[model samples]
Target: MEPSTGKKKTERNWGDKFLNIVEKTGNKLPHPATLFCIFAVAVLLLSAGLAALDVSAEHPDPDIDEKVKVVNLLSKEGIRDILTKAVDNFTGFAPLGVVLVAMLGVGVAERSGLISAFLKKIVMGAPDMLITAVVVFAGIMSSMASDAGYVVLVPLGAVIFLSKGRHPIAGLAAAFAGVSGGFSSNLIITMIDPMLGGFTQESAQMMDSAYTVTPAANLFFMMASTVLITVVGVLVTEKVVEPRLGSYTGSYKQDLDSLKPKENKSLKIALFALIAYVIVVALMTVPETAILRTDEGALLADHESPFIGAMIPLIALSFFIPGLAYGISVGDVKKDKTVVKYMEDTMSTMGGYIVLAFVAAQFVAYFEWSNIGFILAINGAEFLQAINLTGIPLILAFILVSGFINIFVGSASAKWAIMAPVFVPMLMNMGYSPEVAQLAYRIGDSTTNIISPLMPYFAIIVAFAQKYDKNIGIGTLISTMLPYSIAFMIAWMIMLSAWLLLGLPIGPEAPIYY
Candidate 1:
């Protein structure tokens, strides 16, 4: 018994030590927006040095005769271009407009009280045995509604667990695991699908002009990942995370009342509204003569199709309609002014992200304008090929690189914008599809989000945990979520390996090979 106790203490100490290091290191990092500013400065300096040294790479396309060279941002013309195009960079940024449009609808859904009520409806009825899994599953699904899960489900997970006499932090870990760690996995397409897919498509087009990555690029794999993450979240919560938490000794009390009658009616109304909205969208895309389709009536075959272009807006409306229905049913939307106020309030919360996006947009523009990214991708491909690290090994290496970068930069889009320019083209040159590359990046980005201190929601989650146990700190949150991060990484890696071995289609038209 003494030996066993000592072994347990040693093992526990090791985990605590590692998690403490991660928490301290991550906390030392600058805000993600500031990190992008630093990266932009680095890119500028690197561009100048590389340009002076005449660093260049042969264009991959045989049709393109020009060598891609690093353009020095320190040049007079480059300075003029930078000053002139800053606003254009922010406005023309791929994810910005689309995400804003998508979130507008999501904001309506969230502010209408529909998202909260809907999440509660799913979680409140979960059986004691399956409640952890249910909360985690709801968290994963809530990404479809954007950051509403952080606002609704994380705290709700604690309340539900407390109501069931389970450790609330364990429940919060399960929720955070799903909400942040499993963020990249979803049964339905969300803002990220198209957002990352756009980056992939842009990068692939640098090599192959015809490559088209759609919102459904990683749909099948992400759907599978949703199940994998849910199972992992449940197992890690029940097995590793919860046991470590021991018992709930916190005196915080929660009223375990079921969803209100009005909320239930709101859900039904929201469902009907959602159904109606889906039918309207399907009508536009399903018919042969549909204006949203291509000349041959294909919806997604032509990336230029109206349906393809309209998809994100349609997604926003899907949430907006249901939320408006729920809001009206529940009297949250009493007038046009009330609806507008809710939308404003929701968008107001996005000010920080918008600010982050400004810096990220400029960084991406600088990287693109300097052509340093293209040169790096070309050189990186050659280096990898020379070392014979081409296929699965390369994929794993890229995932690790992405995960390492993710520790400091938490926004998926911001990290991907930086990574994709280098990696997507590099992978394409290595004979892998950009879609596959994006999927690998997503795996790395998602798995590490739970443990990253820079994750915008990390502090928010720590606050949530502290509500139950005032002693909860950053390290406590990190230690609790560490299990989920590790479990997710291993399980997700296995799935990716199996996926490659099986040569499965990751999405509708997403091929694994270039």
Candidate 2:
């Protein structure tokens, strides 16, 4: 099924063989939930063995100046701790609550058909000159709304492309590339900034007690990346991915019905509600004495602000109120019971994720408690420090390592918690700032997300793809997305290299040097 791309058979065949091997090896693994369970067990055994070997690292943070040793899960105290915290682990998993809360509002928009209508209107009304770029841009911007892009934009990409007689998978690829692959890139500050920045700050404090890493440390770089990624996404989609995908012959076709009079009226109501909601939010967030503003007068800009904590619930309300307005206008919602039903339906779809989350949470928690990740990171840092690699080469090497690690461990904050304590101090000693190190790690983390099987959303993208072609598998999805990954890695690294070479500030008051 390989299209004649004018490449040599040897080159094409070699690529195909490698992808086949990857697919087969990945398929050989058990289900993701089961795999996480195995990972949890492996951490247990590894921790015990390493503990017996007397492996440990001196704590980086001065407050915890003692040696950090591995806690063997096989021990009596360890087992008891694990058993006691199992429920807490599952409940406290970061993504679980974020996803659930966001979906509650999104569920309303989706079920009320507001999201569908909005997406359809955007796609259908947009000129062909801007459709692909808009989709990619929209996906990139969705970071503010959390994972709503994945659920709403991804499938909509396919539907929009199909409506326009383009290959749907290509559209899916573009959206996935923008959403997951460009995760670290956005025009506005996102939850990721504070999430990873907290880890970076914790690590930096080990070396410099007074060091601080703000959430906006990488804002400038990330903002630039947003534009870079959108352009790259558009180019890859139009030039490479679409040509490779050829024409759409899929069984699934979008029902691109034009809006009826009542639906149009409903859409008008939704628009008015959305505009009014935005105005109210602006009023609350803009002024110095605004209710939603922090005591310092920043609204959702500071990590410690109540606005940050309130964003999820606010997101839910944003969608919910507008969706409710639209639904009521269209007669889709007669009473509160219908809204309750929509939320229930959304919650019901979360069963698989809940099981996966239970196991993943255990694995993450066990890994942290065991301290294997910490020890390895420390040892790795020591080795690199001994070799004394410096400058952009060092940054590039770190990005590559981070990317490789991302394939196995999917959570950004989890991996950073393990890695930052080691790399941050080590790099600071080498005269590079923690913000630079964190930015490098983020480049690595985001570039490979599209191709990594372990990413939390990877399976969902596969399922989304299968809606178009039932034969779509893990390998197929990976192969399809590999180009985006490769292109992003190359392009993003180049961009970062340029920034580093010029010694540009990564963000506001975020210098490259210590």
Candidate 3:
């Protein structure tokens, strides 16, 4: 019998159609490298405009007898100096040096099969309901290892789902949502804590020359955020992602041997090594006599303290030392040469990131030279203050504004460097603490990460998705992840509101108000 028209099978071919559009549009749009160059040019032009108008907060009071001249970017010397200094700073940036150093240990973990083994054990062993939670939890934990979540676990999420007979794209969405969307929320202090803390301190100094912000100021809030984000992430994945995917009958397959029980010897060795490493690190920070502590018997309490400044290096070593030991015991890394090779390999993957960083650094340097960010911030803050808005409304506004800016400029630290100088002090003057302001900025910054194409790693994720289904593209990926993004944003904002109402500290000594 012929099926009725309504019941007849229709070949929608949505995936193919979507890919065609993506390919077409991508061809028309500027190259990613060119896009960055355009951003540099835009910033340069803006700086020139601001300079020509003498629009800056640094100008001397008109009532003062001394006349001050604005530095114009249009001048040959000014343009040359801006470009020269930006290039120099990009080459010599401290964070780039730190990331490169840390990648050495991270590379070994990846190449030695240690990271893969660990992820497989966790994903395969966890119950179905627990998979989402586990992925989110893992995402939170990955911040300790820098960009490992984006680079490693995001693709692994899809592989795990494929092994479980589920839609691999859904798994990718879940992991990407958790890793990038929940980036600011983590159980442990990471390289980002210190980096953002430095910006906060610099901004605070502008208001009160004696003021200093501690790295741990928002630790309490970040710890709470970990739980909040994980729960929200899991719920979104289960309710939104899984349902949308329906019953997966995808052709992707996984090797059952990978899931089979191994000797468990490597697991035990890795476990013991991890425990010992933790104990040693704890000892270093626990006692007043520990060398990592400051004169005041605090770890990472002071801005100039070595412990706070060197935390990234310490974190790198922690991962490397344990991972190295595990590799040697398991015969994955035979000698020191293998370890060095792993380090070099990890660095090789950073070529694109380095280029992005160079362009971003140029934009940042030029913006600073023009003083436009500061001028805008100061004027904006003063306007906000004049309106006498409540603390919550003010912060909420800042979050929205920051989120808008995030779509175009994806670097969190760079965004904060520009926003913090104005927002932090302004909020402080309005009786809010720098920690509160920083937390708000973080929430806004993180929520938009998954949605922004400007984010350096977003394309990497799209490629990861294509590995599972050749037809998948940006639209499909975005649609899959949008639920988590919306859910996370609403839930996180609610959590922040509740925290504010409860007068809970965002971190140790982090307060809602001054």
Judged by lDDT, which candidate is best?
A: 2
lDDT of 2 by residue, 137-162 (tens): 88898877666677667876877787
Q: What's the lDDT for residue 96 in model 1?
A: 63
Query: Among all windows of ten consecutive residues in candidate 2, which has the lowest summed lDDT?
Result: 2-11
Clashing pairs in 1: none
TM-scores for the candidates: 0.68, 0.84, 0.72
The local distance difference test score of model 3 is 0.69
lDDT of 1: 0.75
The worst-scoring run of ten residues by lDDT in candidate 3 lies at 2-11
Clashing pairs in 3: 220-507, 221-506
Instruction: Compute the lDDT of residue 117 as modeled in candidate 2.
Output: 78
For every model shown, the clashing-pair count is: 0, 0, 2
lDDT values for all models = 0.75, 0.80, 0.69
Ranking by lDDT: 2, 1, 3
lDDT tens readout by residue for model 3, 1-514: 2211121112236643443454445435554556557766876777677667766553222233542334566579876887568768687644456556666766776677666667667666568767877777777778765565776668767767766666676678778887875568887776577778888887777778887777777788788888888888888777666665556554556543453344256756777888898888888878997878887786654346656666667767766877887788777778788898888887887775577567656655665565555455445545656677777888877776676666655667877876786688888888888888888888888888887665657656765565655555555566666667667778878888888888888777667777
Task: Give the clash total for candidate 1.
Answer: 0
